[model samples]
Target: MEYLKVEEGDQREPVSPTGQFLNSEALSLCILGVLELGVPISIDESHMDSLVKDVFLPTNPRFSSIMVEDENGEKLWKRVKVKIKDHIKTPTFPSGLSPKIYDKYIDDYISDIATEKLPVTRPLWQIHLINYPTSNSNAASSMIFKIHHSIGDGFSLIGVLLSCLQRADDPSLPLTFPSVPLSSTNKDSNGLFKKVSRIFSVVTNTVSDFYTSIVWSSLLEDDMSPIRSGVAGVEFRPFSVATVTFSLDHIKQIKSNIGAKTVRVQAKQIQLHWCCSTRGNFAVMFPIKEMIKLDSKTPWGNYFAFLHVPLPKLTDDDSTSYSNPLEFVWKTREIINAKKSSLGVYLTGRLLQVLKILRGPEAAARYIHGTIKNVSMGITNLMGPVEPMTLADHPVTGLYFMSVGAPHSLVTTIMSYNGQLRIAIGAEKGLIDAQKLKSCIEDAFQTILKAACDDDT
Candidate 1:
């Protein structure tokens, strides 16, 4: 195996083996974050270069360099002088463009560019800076990053991207937790029979999980939901992104209504799909703790295995109000807890390892191609700065991002900044309107909120 620092260019290797199977030219993973900075960039060539060389490149090395072709599969990033003008673009909007029109332009722009391949010959990323006068007296601005999926996975990309940001309040502080404090459970005393029972319970759970992962999951076709059918046909299609915002208070409001007083970041997905059957046909959750642990020195790069779960679809029924959501939240908690107690994750990891050795990269890659085509959708939520962040001395008031490519009709990216949760849905336009899904999310939250408000009344 070959190695390279994330900034040093091993974009398509060990960090993410799936990169080898993916389309380098046609499909790309974009980290398009919209920055609503109280301050806007004063576009000038030198300043842009300084921003790139000083602020961006060092933060995520994959940005300034390109990969050199290698045999025996040892990859590395080689640095080239990145021209500021070539990478950063400032596009002017038509005169008298309203904020509403500007908003429309953004949606259209993201859709149009979703399938547009990055220039593979150069470094695999670019940034778009938009600061235009709108119908409102106040002008708006955003910074967009378009990058190849091969470069890094969500976990790595988010860390480095946030590293590039400065706290709007305190530049000296780190964007993420300077150091996350970890907790471990202490062993409790129990009788000898209880200990034996505990061991027996562990063994039985492992056997059951193995049976389900290999037998039940492999044999039974995925169940149909709002997105894909149980036996959904896989196809290569263009994808689009719809960024929607929800209030943080509303999310908590809904959670509290479900009789669960405590909520964690990872549990929100359960809240969305608890009562529904959610399937991950093509997309499976990958366990990456082996490589990217809480204390791993290298924090950037891909490290995941695949697992699938079903989520309940949302509805427009006003009569049911809280019942459905309440059911979902509790069910999600139970299902996710059961999954945690199983050996399915361990089994899948070993299975993929065996596949890689027995079948080789081509065969393994084919499985990814098949799975993504079959499942065609994945959602990942990354929490952003609870406090406002800035870029190049400009205060960023808002931000959201998502990606689109083959075998994926809908890829949802959830991000929260300050007190706002932005649910960005990237999907195939022919199959569904991205806005329709956004409306569903908004409606689901509204009903949950109403339920909570009614309880107060």
Candidate 2:
């Protein structure tokens, strides 16, 4: 892997706090990987140039500027710069093709991006066009995009890219780039009292909002208890063996049947079904409730907790179906409700406190690695149609995003694009067999699709 430094004195700004949180660690890792794959992809020269040029230039806050004190004790945002390397032309892969060749290329690039440091000089993002073999006989390739977590969170980055693109046929017109509006607060002012007051206000609000979330979650609902841990030596796992997709109508029906009072009922059922079907050992389902508590004070991005839904052991003749899954669903709901009191935020704060004590980024890195295995997977469902997405003038047929799996065997990601729900599952290499997981996911999706179709008819 090659490293590029951004030139000193160039100005560029960091994204907002919400954007920073979203673009933070996990998202950043994925972006870096995608950017490394950009070399061989079909990106237009102009688009690529715009990405590098617009993204790297100086900003109001000057992203390269880090706050520090001078010898005389005056404090200021010190600007630092670094250089960037051109794309490597030499073949990073071996001469002949082998089994799972795509995996080799992708994995090698992933590792390279993961280890590379973000340049302090420019905005921390990269774009790489991947030229890779695909199953389609008509088209020989595919494209991947890599971005840094510090640049923007997933949604923010998606929004940024989408803004730059037009429909394929309309691509001839120059796309308009939207400038991010400045925050109301002034950063250059030398008033120490104002700065301190702002910091205090932010902390106070965050703490208050966190407590409020706990109260709402607690008073809101109840779920079943989760399974206790056992001593079984964990086996290495790979991608999911099965996945199921529910149509919008089907999900709505489930909500109507369960409790028409709240949209969360459907989420409850999905989590319950997965927990019971896989047995408690396979994974736990958590409903992300952070979005529901949105208020003026609440954080803008993800601040939800995963309330573990424990599955009951299935008997030999047990049939896993949508109706039966409701039992497990309600149980998980109870767990979520139980923690709705201050306990949820308290626990989270405690965890964050532990993380803080670790000291330094390396400690944070270790913390993430150690925590992945405690849960089997995560699933997020957004209620509405996502804004349409396209690439190189071609409307995207489908898209799904999954974080690279933690130490855990697998993670499943689901989102609705256009009118269709898309799912992507990630798993570790040795733990779960990829083919088996793929088959299982396909089977699950088919089952759900068929069930939805029948219900519609």
Highest TM-score scorer: 1
Tens digits of per-residue lDDT for model 1 on 265-363?
333543254233344333434325422222225455555555554444435563265354555556556655555556666676576567667875555
Give model 1's clash tally. 23
For model 1, where is the 10-residue window of minimal lDDT?
Answer: 287-296
Query: Best candidate, lDDT-wise?
Result: 1
| Model 2 per-residue lDDT tens digits across residues 1-457 | 1222333453433333323322333322333222111123555566555544454333223233433333432223344552323322222455456425655565555435434544533434444444554222122343444444434334433334444444433555433321223335566754998778766665665565455434322332212123212112222222232223445555556556544334443443353343343433223223333222212232223233334333444554555432444444455555444433223444543554465455533343333333333444444443322344345454554444444423344455555544445444454444455456556555543444345345442
Runs in model 2 with CA error above 4 Å? 1-47, 55-123, 133-141, 148-157, 166-343, 350-370, 379-387, 445-457
**TM-score, prediction 2:** 0.55
- Per-candidate TM-score against the hidden true structure: 0.77, 0.55
